[model samples]
Target: MIFLKLFRESFLFAYDALRQNKLRTFLSLVGVTIGIFLIIFVFSAVDTLKNNLQKSVNKLGSNSIYIQKWPWVNNEDSPWWKYLQRPTPKLREFDELQKRSQTALAVSYEISIDNRIVKYQSHTVEGAQIDATSHDHDKTWNFDFEDGRYFTEMESRSGSPVTVIGHDIAADLFPDGGAVGKALKIMGRNVTVIGVFKKEGSDILGISDDKEILLSLNFAKNVIDVQNASYNPQIVVRGKNGLSDLEVESEVRGLMRSIRRLGPNNEDNFALNKTTILSNQLDIVFNVLTKVGGFIGLFSILVGGFGIANIMFVSVKERTNIIGIQKSLGSKNYFILLQFLIESIVLCVMGGLFGLGMVLAVAALVKAGTDVQIVLDIKNIIRGISYSIIIGMLSGIIPAYFAAKLDPVEAIRSN
Candidate 1:
């Protein structure tokens, strides 16, 4: 009952003090509000970016591993320049790896032909990205077909003049008509359109997969008139179930080294890139950014805390005689302390709530404007509220203690 009475009296005193100086209270909260706003806003944006990046990486598949000329996540010391110095991995290397590895489920090689002009009837589209991949490309990449089927393994081996069109390419080439069974001229060579790919929405990198074309490995070589012997291929290996990615990667490296006949102390001439490594690197970058944002937001809370302390000091000076009168009326020292503490808490909470509101409003705006996903987790909100309360308690300590210890006779005589 005594605690309840103390709480009620504290609230009443806090309300009266705030009402007496509305503008001063507002000024005190501004620092906290700005600080919380920055912390919340930056965290929301970084969370969105991280989620998108993970999605993009997962699209490549967890079990699948890629072997290319350059590393996916390039480092300063070992740059693309290092990869450029090495010889390109040949398509034969993929065949050798597939033959040697018993742990792999499917292995394929891809070589892209860029800026190719695609034509059907009178319509022409330029700068099309065409990929020449093996029959396993569809199964390996989890590609979904729209209207027709992917090229058969026989067609890939026979180098059949067939093509699978991307959604955008089909729309551009056929326009009013469907693309199935149609012949489109690619780089002055006629190729029959066997399949059209369905649209897969933008990846985490904000890239659409709709603007690509796929062709059988041999057919692509013939269409581009590139020498099959000299062609550089990107090897994609999918490990069988229960086989670790590391094991598959190590096996592939060993096989490639043997095929290329690299000396024992020399590094392998090709680059191996994996999705997991890329995802981990991106995670580290986001974590650092979050910490930096939190520290910057801490400064705002500090300023608000100082303001609360200053305001309480001023209030104490202004209400000296009021304190003396309350003490003369038999008010306890604890009561005086409770009143000032409540005032500080109320101010800090108000600022926190306002900052939360602003963060939500901006987050909503960003979500509506873009496809980025920025979710406000319960934990983050809880942390913000807790931090505000801590700031209030710490800031109010000095003022509350000074008010409680004041000599009533001296306080009254000053007025």
Candidate 2:
């Protein structure tokens, strides 16, 4: 009951002080408000970037591994020249892996084709990325169609000129919504649009189905030399549902070595890449960015802490007479200390809340104006509030102790 009465009295006194010195109070809190905003804003931006990059990684199939001539990251031991001399994954190797591997649920061969003009009567979308893949491409890759369906097994084997277009391609060529069944000229060859890919917006790694056109590898072989090094051929293998990625990777690595006829002593020519490599690289990058952001934000928070300390000192000086009167009324020393400390905490919390509001407002504005997403999750909110409380306690402790130690007669006479 005594503590509650002391709290109520302290809060009323703080409120009165604010009402009487509005400008002074606002000025004192500006540092704290700005500090909290900087810290939270930086954290939110890092989180958003990390999330977007992870989404891009997911689109690449987390459980799938790639067999390619070149490694995603250069291997210091093998070097780029050695990787260059390695043969690209071929259809024969893809077939051998599919036949031999027990851990692989699906195996696919894909080749990249340079930007080509795609035209549907009067409409044309230039510089569209084109890729050709084998029968199990849909199983190896993760995607959804906005319309129609994937290539039938017969269509993939027979080199049928059916194609699946991305969202942007469909939007540009068939504005009226009937993209399926229409013929579009790609690489000067007429191909029927069998399906439309669901819209997936671009990510940091430039991975999205929104700007691609997919066709069967057999059909591409008829038009161009898929075995050519310029086409960048690769094999993708997705693991079975119950198997771990390591288990699948081990089997695939051994199969590739056997298929290439590499002796036990000879180094493996092909590189096996996983989404986890990219994810680990991203983790390193984001961790550094987060630390740098926090380091810069702490300087501002330190300045704000000093400003709060100065305010607490001023508050103590102004309320000396009140402290003496409370002491004379039999109020304990801890009560005076706790009352001042709580008032400081309340003030800093109010400032932190204002800063958090500003962050929310900016995040909403940015989301409305841009394609990028900003996440101000519950963890960040709690972190901001916790920082405020710690700063308030640190700033008020010394001043609160001085207020508690003042002699009643001296404090009362000071006024």
Model 1 Cα shift for residue 305 (angstroms): 1.5
Considering only N, C-alpha and C atoms within 3 Å, which residue pairs clash in candidate 2? Answer: none
**Cα lDDT, all candidates:** 0.80, 0.87
Best by lDDT: 2
Off by over 4 Å in 1: 1-22, 79-82, 119-125, 142-185, 189-207, 225-232, 325-330, 408-415
Residue pairs with clashing backbones, model 1: none
Per-residue error for 377 in candidate 1, Å, reads: 2.2
Residue-wise lDDT of candidate 1 within 1-415, one digit each (tens)?
A: 9877777776676677678888887788898888777777667767677777766766676778788777777666776666778776676677788788877898988877778788888999899988888878865676677889888878989999888888988888888858999998876788899898888767666545578878888876665644242345688888888887788888878887898999999887887778788778877888888988899888989998999899889888888888989898898998889888877887787788888999898877867887445767666777777778889888898999899889999889868
What lDDT, from 0 to 1, does candidate 1 have? 0.80
